[model samples]
Target: MSSDAPVDARAPGQKTFFGHPRALSTLFLTEMWERFSFYGMRAILVLYLTASVAEDGLGISESTANAVYGTYNAMVYLMALPGGWVADRLLGARRSVLWGGVVIAAGHYVMAIPARWSVFAGMTLIVLGTGLLKPNISTMVGGLYDRDSPRRDAGFSIFYMGINLGAFIAPLITGFLGEKVNWHLGFGAAAIGMTFGVLQYVLGRRNLGDTGDRPADPLLGADRRRALTRIGVAVLVLLLVLAVLAVADLFTVNTVVNSLTIATVVITIGYFARIITDREISSTERSRMKAYLWLFVFAAAFWLIYDQAGSVLNLFAADRTDRDVLGFTFPASWLQSVNPILIIIGAPLAALLWLRLGHRVSTPVKFAVGLVLNGLSFVLMAAAAQAAVGGDLVSPWWLVAVYAIQVAGELSLSPVGLSATTKLAPVKYASQMMGLWFLATAVGDAVGGQVARLAETWPEPTYFLAFGLASVALGLGAVMFTRHISRLMAGIH
Candidate 1:
């Protein structure tokens, strides 16, 4: 839920869904379809990029395509910072979500048009729309329950299920249409999913009571005018810069991606500096922020490998994995579903394990566990790549096992990292710390995309093995400093 949004009293005799707010069902379906559109497009993005031009594909080089995928993911996460601001100060969460869904639907519809430029244009729109929609909707979910309600965590758990469910189902639908039939048709399917989400969200608003009905902090007349003017000027300046780059013949896709990647890293560093140097915060708060920096590095490292599943591993599934079952071959993108399904199955079990263990395990230790497991996943992938080196297709089970390991790593670190971010944040920078946490992902994806370029020049097995070992070494190093990080945490679990 939004930190600034006012929580309102529930209406008397309000209807409930499974003893929770009736509005949860609405938000649940909204997020489900949004993710359906997102993952559905993602599952086939690289495959579509590298497919033969004769098959109506882009035919871009594999390394460039992988970089494009990474950069796109980075932009989506990066935008969330501005997205949250728009909701808090201008449109409010409800309107931001509504408009965001509309734009996302429009993006998918644009992709469904079979022109060469539509793909890039559609992706740009999707990135902007997702930025607006993603964070605010989660904030709205938080608004549904009081800060101290026991049901709050459970509500988020149910919401988490919605996310994984969409991810698990999207590739099966979109992958089949994109690979076996027309790619545009698959994109059309995603557009339809988001449309359903928007329609349902609109119709279900009555159940929401006062949630996100207005901005948390609306600007006054003169201030609003000034803010709007500044926004316009900023947009114009950005456009002018792009035009200059284009005129200079420096506006190629790779150039844009490289610029954005560098910008993401620079912004992350600046944000950290701004927070840690703030005179408003206490020494203890500063110490916690210092510890958070280490966890941020670890989180970035983890995502650098985990997110490659859609690019490097997707290509592997297509080219090297034998997907034949009972004489029927499957779409390679279907393999993307494996990770989400495993996440769905493992999440409850993980929660149980953590509950049973409680604070006996420290945050840094769990992070080490995650990093080591993530590294082991890639180490296993090295063996799979080696098996395919002789032009033999390896069994599909190799990819399944790989996703299982990655999911375990995700369960160990991702939620724990979010919890740690909240616990360690200075009071002055509490909400902003969440944005910093997301920046970790943006940084990882940006750097990882650049790193992926080496795959084109290096042997596949060597690429996997080297990174795998590096991550393992980082994990072991984190273990060595666990005591120090715990002390820096200053009573935070």
Candidate 2:
């Protein structure tokens, strides 16, 4: 696991392609099944919430459902902070992933139970579990190779493809089952997928070896003790606040959950600030870290638009799109797969395009391009929304086209941002810095949900326009700062 050790860039029994380790397959399958479970649950969650009570749903209003969707998705990303912390400081990524899988499995099983209370409890557990698993698993992937290893980017691409493969399939299966048969059955299937992921990780332990274990630094133990103590105090204070809010009738369960989530976000931001501003970090590294923080904020805008595939877009598919195809109708839920489908097809082409333009574009320029494309996708959707006026169902092709454009944007930004973070993060705090990167994603998700909720208060066209214009503006701003940011990443890569 030493940085100098040569990677086994081959299939288990075949020749290597692009110098990536064969052990990547183990990580790939594990992530694939985990995403299958996650996306499957996501495809059905909004529909389940807004469907009729007679159908065993929450029967919430559209705005409320979107709010719930936004909050849940936000919490999922926010949890990654603690998940990474636990992995880096206490349990190590391997054990944390194992335990996270267990928690997620249990949560999904709870969702499969036939009660409103079960739904609440199950979703909470799943959010917490995801926080623990997502960041740690990603950190482990970076661990598998040395810094600036030529294979790193390609390995991440292959790994991301696995994520899309699971995502592409999940919505089709879960969406159909949830809409056509029973919602809980779809959740049950998701739980089963998680079980498979857990099993794969357990069986593939040797492939990971000591890559994700605790660092050998003697100071590591003291840091872990301090972190755990702070976490414990925070949890206690959160519980006390929840109790007070409930007694005052100012907090339903959802309100308490939202407050805790917001608190977690604030605390995480404070933690990163403390680390970056500390005198211990060299001045040069501090400048690079500041650049990373800026990139994170810009990347958050991309996620805000992209993640709508699960929340606002899901609702649009269910309510406004033409689901009928050749005399057979497809479930609106299945449309959620469109983004991943496009990603699977467009990723290679996007990669080639980047290679061709390597000398012409900086990472920030590519990110700006991504943001603009993502913004345009929403504008296209806005046009579709206008066409769907007077209760008409717009052609499904419109949704497909939007997802295709959005995927193109994703290819330009998401993977590149990940690479940039690792390269720029100081070696001593790499895992924690990556955790902050994921936290930006959490913030974007929360903001997306809020945007969706606000849009729910307006006409469809207005909502689309708002999101589209804001995304374009964000992209333009990022491009303006590209030169300054590039200077910060100087000498890192």
Candidate 3:
């Protein structure tokens, strides 16, 4: 999504291999395999961290594991800004993606070696690699289709399907091995998955053509030196901060988690303030940006609810949900796949439904619907949690239903929000605005992690119900403001 490339409907000469562009296929499969590694590692990270050392895990506390998960996920998105900057200034998306792939595979493999030092080191590498890969690759995908091309939305959907395909299968394989066989095996599987993505990417680089080969604004000699120096300074400062924190006995899980949460929020506010006050945009553009700011709010809320799948709900599935289906127990990591599987099945149908009725469905209305659906999912989970308060395991269907509802919610908010983001972004700061959109996710995920950390402290029913009610209330509030937000959108729908 980090792209400021001008829309060109110029016929892609010699590029009509998929009823659109051959590059879309290459990008799609690369991202699919990339996501396979990502989601595969994610599916078991918290579980591995919190499991007993006897089980080949780190034996961290549940709260610590959840916090680490939250912070890791948060950094993954927050780094996209600098990663996109690197591409826009020096590396270009293709090289960034390639290097990112290398780092990602290395990270997974490191974690596969099974040691105390490897855990944090591997996570840091994945975070950096993901930061480099995610936004730029998404920008490349957007670059593949012209703005006016009808295939643009469809292309993203197809691309998204590839992502889900990876997500859907990753857990079935990695989850089984990680949870049942060995955690290191699962991590290694994730590495292998990324290896496939990298090999395929190299083979198909020609298909990518010159889409993300050049910078929108190339840096001059002085600018290049200053940028590199700044990166070095930033790295030094970060190391110093870590050293200070260690000296103070404050380099703990909560410190890192809370600091990141604050950082995400501050960055979000700064981005919105900058975009809204920019003189380069027209009044209409400014107003649309403001509307986007609201979308950011709703989006953060949605993700805060959604991201619990990896932390709170993951733990629930492991300990609280009955996976015994006719005496055949399934791995808890398999629970992560249910959402992507549903998304794979439901995304196309949702796309079709939107194509048929998009004219009538306002963006805010879609966001409102998404919020309501999200709340409903938590409501279902809350009921299950209530039923299980007496030390009974809830039926697995409760989780399935939660994921199914969330799939609907995610379909509405995520895709619509992505389109709305690019549409509403100020042209001068388009890539940064994309980074801002993901900042909302960073905030949500960080906050969700904090909430998950508290899960053990609160009664299951109360925790679920409180968050569920909050979501429903926010949804209703958005519905009430739909017309106002639409007016501010300045002709974008």
Q: How does model 1 score by TM-score?
A: 0.98
lDDT of each: 0.91, 0.81, 0.87
TM-score result, candidate 3: 0.94
In model 3, which residue pairs have backbone atoms overlapping below 3 Å? none
Each model's total of backbone clashes: 2, 1, 0
Candidate 1 segments exceeding 4 Å error: 1-12
- What is the TM-score ranking, best to worst? 1, 3, 2
Question: What does candidate 2's lDDT look like per residue over 92-204, in tens digits?
Answer: 77677788889999999999997887777898899888887888777677777776677777788888889999998998888888888999999988999999999988887
lDDT of 2 at 34: 90
lDDT tens per residue, model 1, 1-493? 5433433335577777667788888999999999999999999999998898998899988899989999999999999999888888899888999999999999999999998889889999999999899998998998888888888899899999999999999999999999999988899999999999999999998867678777888887998999899999999999999999999999999999999999999999999999999999999999999999999999999999999999999999999999889898999999999999999999999999999999999999999999999999999999999999988999989989989998999999999999999999999888778888989999989899888877778889999999988998999999999999988888888
What residue runs in model 3 are displaced by over 4 Å at the alpha carbon? 1-17
Between prediction 2 and prediction 3, the one with superior lDDT is: 3
Error of 2 at 41 (Å): 0.3
